[model samples]
Target: MKIDAGNVNAVPSKRLFLSIIADYDLNRSICELIDNGLDVWTRAGRRQPIVIDVHLDPDEQSICVEDDAGGLPREDLGVIVGPGQSGSVATAHETIGIFGVGTKRAVVALAKQIVITTRYQHAETFQIGFDESWLNDEDWVLKVHQVDDLPVGTTRVELYQLRLLLDDDNIKMLRHHLSATYANFLTNPAVMIRLNTVPLEPRFFDNWAYPPEGSPQRWSGPMRTPSGKLLRVDVIAGLSKESSPATGDYGVYFYCNNRLVAPAMKSFEVGFTRGQAGLPHPKVSLTKVIVSLNGDADEMPWNSSKSDVSTKHHVFTALHDWLVTVVKHYATLSRTWEGQWPEKVFVYDDGDITFNEVDDFLTAKRAVLPNLPVVRPRLPVRITKANSGVAQAKPYVVGLYEGVVAARTLVKQDLSQRNWLAFNLLDVSLTGALKEYLVNDAGAELSSLDLAQLINRDRTVSADLRARVPLPDPLWTKVEQMGRLRHDLTFGRAAPKISDEQLAAADAIVSEVLARLFDVKLAA
Candidate 1:
């Protein structure tokens, strides 16, 4: 007999087994479960008044919630408290509490002990108490008792061993959260919720009353989402004075399945529409943009943590495109209303090579010009054999007069390519030859050399060369003064000083010359 007893095994009862494995965080979990449960209850067409009461006592470190909802039946209590129960599945509707593990598991997560009191309309009130230690103890059991003095239509849940303290700010935020969550219930008047001693208020933006005097212009369009869903857009613009620049004040709200979710940002595609308007007014804050997207039970994009929507889905893409188009359109409208055009215009032509050719020629000349001692005196002097008979000699002495003249010639040549007339006038000022030639050859002896053609053919000639090349205006005055000196010097007359008035006149003349020569307007 003793040997046979060793082969026997003990099997724990089902109730005792699940009780030991119930999860922790029971208090917080129970609150969320109740919230979701109320959502389901309202949607199911339950006519009874639903009330949620939350009580927190920091002194006792306890939190409790009581609801006047359809209490759980005695038979269903096991499934509600037990693990892996799905009571809502039999109802065939999308219940907020889809998984049966919600309330009990959440309660187990929050506190070490919990007590649930429930009463059905026709059934006797029942109380069930469980401790955290009983979850794993094989011999432990849940204490269930029936009572006659329980409230007529209330289900109460009390949690002990709180992990988070509820302060004033937290309470206020909770109230706001509940009001937004249950906005649809406000119109029904059958649902009432209270936290501490204050009653909760539900806020719905759609019902916001407009000012009585203004005729607000309403703008609406269908925004197509990438997922092929047509999201309707509703905008209220012209809320301000029509004659005022700020009259374009508008509010854009997004709704999904009739519930306001979040404010839309301009960075998002939906926000692009607002940018298009180019409204001078500042953009509305995120809190001001009310967005509500209808969420279905099948849409897993909306997880329990409803902070963000799933971007990978088609709905997100569609929403993005719609917003961007709206912003673009608004920007265009703003520009049109302001009667303004873009300040700058850019033109590209493939066939224009004249400018390029000029640039290329200048680059080539510059590369070779630096090496030519004729242009730059600082270049190393080079000795060359003259006919192999004379000793190696430098061709010409580096005289300041000759060097200045050479530099002036190089500038003249360059400017002549673009504007020959300006170069010629500058040359007349630099060289005494212009006056000498004009005076020597009377009106009858004009040569066949067309001065304009000659200047145009020489691309290297420039205004600086003309100004410094011994021109004739006031040249006699300089020459006579030089001749009166003790030693007779054959250096050409000194170039005239360019005064401010002369410079201004030269600049204006050059501009006009270039405009006519190139047949193009010069930009100031």
Candidate 2:
């Protein structure tokens, strides 16, 4: 095995670039291009504003992303051609995209042919383009040339023959992701990002405030390790503007050398410290904590993509100790306030529509509400806001099965959901099964057995409240039919979660149905 080391590795795999791109989706792929542009802009000291424009055209099957940052310099031309080479090392520490493959990988993921044009302030304007058809060749060359129309201090990428359709849903998704991805930069007046012709505004975390204006800083300090290495941690804990899901931008942020490596994270999520030991309380989401960190690169642990921060560092352990002390005082009022209302009613919106307006719709064919997405549990709901712009919209008409089903009171449905039920009772691997009824031609997935027949079904909602919205007579018939079909599939019997293979197949089918739903929603 230890013979002469004369084996020479030559001719790198040409498909490596193309294959790595498969890991990124439309949103992530688009973010890669935007990140490169921002890096150059930040590297230039942010003295002037940078305007980013994205043009999407489905009919042409093309997309163009342009930015007014300092374009690629002639000296750094190898940055793109080389797989891991980076020019940002000498530039700003906060600049993103050090791997150098961002723009190339993203552009390749979207189109068969791509043209990249750039103009540095001092260097001549140049353009380079390549086609996917050349990916198989071991020695493919990019046709580079000087360009006259390209302006100085600008970088642009034109994509042709898109692999993914530039449809409306994807366009909206791009807009949403870009705004969130660059939320920190877009918050500044100097940076403007536009999708197609529309300007994108940075959406902030519903839980925490940024920069806090003149407000006193809640927490800021440097955590010292056994050695002299210093890990700086800064945090601000505050109330959210509105109630939102805990998963979104609602927690701490971690930055490595001024660039954000992790964002909107709760303390417990990243570490094994005492603060993370407790289960997340229902009120935990109301508190937004922006925890910014800065330290030597080697001291911090960022995943390869730089999207996640590891909790194994000593600084994280120290920060956890500090957070546990302060978390008790942060957003503790939400729980006390909720005690006044019934468990079904939680604080939401500025006082407009409540949950009742959304889930309380009339029964329709195949459980699909004509006015909304899909209804769950039961229905006869509608969501309408008031005409006055200043006043937030409240439930216009609180539809009541109005004492028809005994003395039960119905709970309200969240208004945020328009197309699908916001809450799922089967919040598990089977959650997607709830929506499978919409797309599966095999028939409704609902059980033939009545929900009331299920044990402790009343625990889902107050019976008096739930009984107010009677199960539509038509639904019971569907339940019966599905029950019979399921029984036949199992040889005249029913079993709880049949087989591992069946579970995997069910998951695959659900994924296909959701994909189709996306296609239908975005179809021209």
Best by TM-score: 2
What would the C-alpha RMSD of candidate 2 be, to one decimal place?
Answer: 20.7
Query: Candidate 2: where is the Cα deviation over 4 Å?
Result: 1-3, 10-12, 90-92, 206-217, 223-232, 246-268, 271-283, 294-302, 311-524
What is the TM-score (0 to 1) of candidate 2?
A: 0.57
lDDT of each: 0.43, 0.52
For candidate 1, what is the lDDT?
0.43
TM-score of each: 0.44, 0.57
Model 2, residue 301: what's the lDDT? 53
lDDT of 2 at 480: 34
**Candidate 2 displacement at residue 304 in angstroms:** 3.6
The alpha-carbon lDDT assigned to residue 253 of candidate 2 equals 61
**RMSD in Å for all candidates:** 23.6, 20.7
Per-residue lDDT value at 390 in model 2: 13
